[model samples]
Target: MNIQLKHGADRLLFGMKESDVKALYGEPDRKYKDEDKNVIYLYNDKKVRLTFYQDEEFRLGYIITANNACKVFDEKVIGEEWSAIMPKLEAKGIRAFEKENFDSVDNYFNEANWVIFQVEFGEVIRIELGATINARDEFDWKF
Candidate 1:
């Protein structure tokens, strides 16, 4: 599925409720809470993890995917080397804000939007995308 920067990926939107997700995905294969108590729903077959805020908002907030079929800007990304992917992202006017290496893993994040690419051994291994603050500096609630 295509990563819709600052919005979501697949059919999951950033501000959707837990029930909304369930309606679309049915019961998760495994569900648990993260350190922040945010509920994590895993779809092993879909190769994705969805995190919904456990706070009062209680809405879908982000997606973490290791699916090799993930796409951004309409280009397959998970297995592509930086050399091949960077140019396409740039052409789409998506510029990375920072890139840091943690031993073997490297992360490229964009603050202007809301996408992070995690790479290891020169190929993207995962992607994390979330909601973003709007131009008014307010959290975007994409219901």
Candidate 2:
């Protein structure tokens, strides 16, 4: 998996419609609405979850991938530790982070929480990324 930060990940870019994604990955293992009411399409075999919701248009909003092969900023991040990822994030100028009091997982935020590394057992388990939409460009579609 190749993460392009707020732009999207791999061949699945942000603002992609369901048909666009389905065309790429075929059918999903499961598709349902999440607790937040966002539509979630889960591909269990690929360990990826795609979220879609309505802001202006009902389209892809976020992508969460758990593939250990996932790469971001030219580095393999999944299954990596904070000590290791910290350097990579810092080296890439992703300096802002927040370690909350929760014990389940520690999240590393890069650029206004656009891309996050959800770490558990001291290793990254999932990478959640979202698209950055500038309302000024709402009329322009990038998909």
Candidate 3:
């Protein structure tokens, strides 16, 4: 919800090699190269391109496109057991449903890999899942 960064709130401002960029973000959906020989990282809804040029001192000058990014994560660890984990997840703004109705709520997280937590009717249903966004099934979404 409210993530406050003390210093480097700029998500795109990274200090790693070019090769590691994709590892930071998810795999790039597409790529493009400019006439100047620069590489661009393209996502489904976002794009970031990098350009390199030589300055007067022969130092590398770089230009980065799409300086801002939204960080989404699906993997997480829940410290408490089911009893303790349920309330915690709800506090984080995750919708809680009836555990007996787990099937009804499956679509919520199945369509989105970045699932912080999933609770059911004041009970912990699932936690600590991986970043695996399954294909959307219209039937599954029906509740």
Q: Output the number of the TM-score-best candidate.
A: 1
Q: Provide C-alpha RMSD values for all models, in order.
A: 1.3, 2.4, 15.8
Alpha-carbon deviation at 121 in model 3, angstroms: 47
Off by over 4 Å in 1: none
Off by over 4 Å in 3: 1-9, 47-143
Task: Output the TM-score of candidate 3.
Answer: 0.28
Q: Which digits, one per residue and each the tens of the lDDT, describe model 2 over residues 1-143?
A: 88887678888878888899999999999999877777789998778999887554558888889988899887998888878988887787788886653578887776553777888888888888877746594423347
Greater lDDT among 1 and 3 belongs to: 1
For each candidate, what is the lDDT? 0.88, 0.80, 0.33
TM-score of each: 0.94, 0.87, 0.28
lDDT of 3 by residue, 10-33 (tens): 233222334444555666676666
Give me the displacement of residue 140 in model 3, in angstroms: 50
Pairs clashing within candidate 1: none
